[model samples]
Target: MSTTTTVVDIAPVAEVQKLSLRAADPSESKPEGKAPEQEYRYAHLLPHFSEDRYPPLEPYEHVDPGHRALQHPNPRSFLDTAERVIEITPQLGTEVRGINLAELDSDGRDQLALEVARRGLMVFRDQGDFINRGPDFYLQWGRHYGRLHIHPTSGHPRGYPELHLVYRDGKQSFNFEVDDSITTTVWHSDVSYELQPPGLTTFFLLTAPPTGGDTLFTSQVSALKKLSPQFVAFLKTLKAVHSGVEQAEFSRNGRRGGTVRRDPVEHVHPVVRRHPVTGDEALYVNRQFTRRIVGLKREESEAILRLLYDHIDKSADNQARVRWEPNTIVLWDNRVTAHSANVDFRHLPDARHGARITPQAERPIPALEGLDLSA
Candidate 1:
């Protein structure tokens, strides 16, 4: 493959050099009244902590244990710290655990995030601790990993003024009325219409119907791996039309009293994308926003797109379903999975309310990179 200009950012190199020099100097003394050289020598060998000088570590005390306790009343059965990988079959949509999202430290959060990314989707049942903060809490957790995505037109209700609320019962909500079809759609990645779409989305379900409403997620990586090599090669060469304008327009019409206008929004992205953190390549196209393939005639594009969409739709074994419980939360990687809501309980009297925080992607991974495809 022909290589493009490799632009390397060197801003951090200077700081790294300074730290190295400081560490090399054996005579570099500690601040007044600090520990002796012998005592601090061992600290320098630590990964992040240097023995020579000590900057007060940030207190983890701000992380309240009560937060974890509230989320997991009985930690024994509900909470397990050891890493776990479980497949959620059709029969088991929900995974009940004591993993408290609110109590996760930086390392814990990273571990959980990776697990969620790997598993496609995860559920935290009966998260009463999160309900009070509601959407605000979700925003915090989402932003912890990356920046919150601000909609091109609308603003978030609380955080970013430009991010429009997608909730139907609130200031800017998606209408779940009898006539709405947008929210009831099947298997799709969120906001694929953008050039660089969202990385992850966190949803907090504050309320749920008495029975039958659930969310399903399908693994895109597994789906792509099953495709024939010929089809995979063809897909790699093609780009799909995804439109933000179409979704915005749909949202405008779907929400009651929403003033947002529909525009001719579209973007083209590769059928497969490489994740930044995990370095794993995943199937990236979806049926919802993906309209046609570029570099092909209309008929050819339609035929190819139809087949690909059908493949993604029919791969039921790769999917995981989650039955909602009150104050429950779910998070999934938008880059690697497609999801749908089961609206069987739409007629139920109880309202399902929740907030979703989508983090913006830094860049789109091109198809023919030299980096390892399996990371």
Candidate 2:
């Protein structure tokens, strides 16, 4: 693979020709077995409440959790203790083995934090120990990173407001149905509309389907690096407006029983953001939340955003797909990655339920060039 960091031509003729000439793989069809009807494993954990019962939380500032990793006395010590640390891809995604997240010492936690910041995502399997410890431990572990963010609209489990429930039943259909077509994939950095967006996000699978229900992640750093430097420079000068209006509307329309704990928010973030720990540039605008580029006409912003979205979606080299299983956890730095849930098993009766713990981080900062270190 080319290790050059400099900008290259976008989709050269040779590359196009090579892609066109690629041999097609033989199609193997497997019969879809009937999935047994099942109830959500952690349904008991969910709280019963009316939509108007949740009191609104006041907006507040948050400190970036990555700061602790930066100040750690020994940031790389966890790698020594792990049985193996496999980098899944050259750009992003890591799988660490032989370490239980529940028993992590302060140093181990700090090191893990550093590793997550360096690698865009980390995968841990057989996390039964951590999962069995329950939501109290989960919330505490997340709080160690930063202030836990209570989602404005999502359904959370009872007694644990910090954990956002990602649950779906067989009876419900997705709202994206347009003329009998359902759009399942929506790529986004979680809640980018917030004044302080999520930093490190933890998603723990309680019950996964027999097959399917994988999540897609793409490295924004790699996405930004692929563009020409001139284009990158132009993007760095711009900011995009991210709004939670659509999400709030979805909640209010009885999606989650008309739950709206807090009002929807809107904020402008840089088109290119600088990761606080790695100092890498990442293309920060996302399709779900980002509405328009600041200071641009509606059509102009749409055109530019459409181009960037296509770049992100078409970059196969920069993406990773994570297959889920029960007792599995995937943690990622929300600042540098955009993720989408694969709802391939939507038609099936098998349930895919998970809980996410997200810690709000510092305000989005632009990845500007020509910094004066002397100051």
For all predictions, the C-alpha RMSD in Å is: 20.0, 13.2
- Candidate 1 lDDT, 155-178, residue by residue in tens: 234323323333221122243233
TM-score of each: 0.68, 0.83
The reply for model 1, stretches above 4 Å from the true place, is 1-85, 90-96, 134-136, 152-173, 176-183, 251-256, 261-264, 370-375
Top model by lDDT, which number?
Answer: 2
Clashing pairs in 2: none
Give the clash count for model 2. Answer: 0
Per-model CA lDDT versus the true structure: 0.54, 0.74
How many clashes in each structure? Answer: 14, 0
Candidate number achieving the greatest TM-score relative to the actual structure: 2
Those runs of model 2 whose alpha carbons end farther than 4 Å from true positions after fitting are 1-41, 47-61, 71-74, 173-182, 369-375
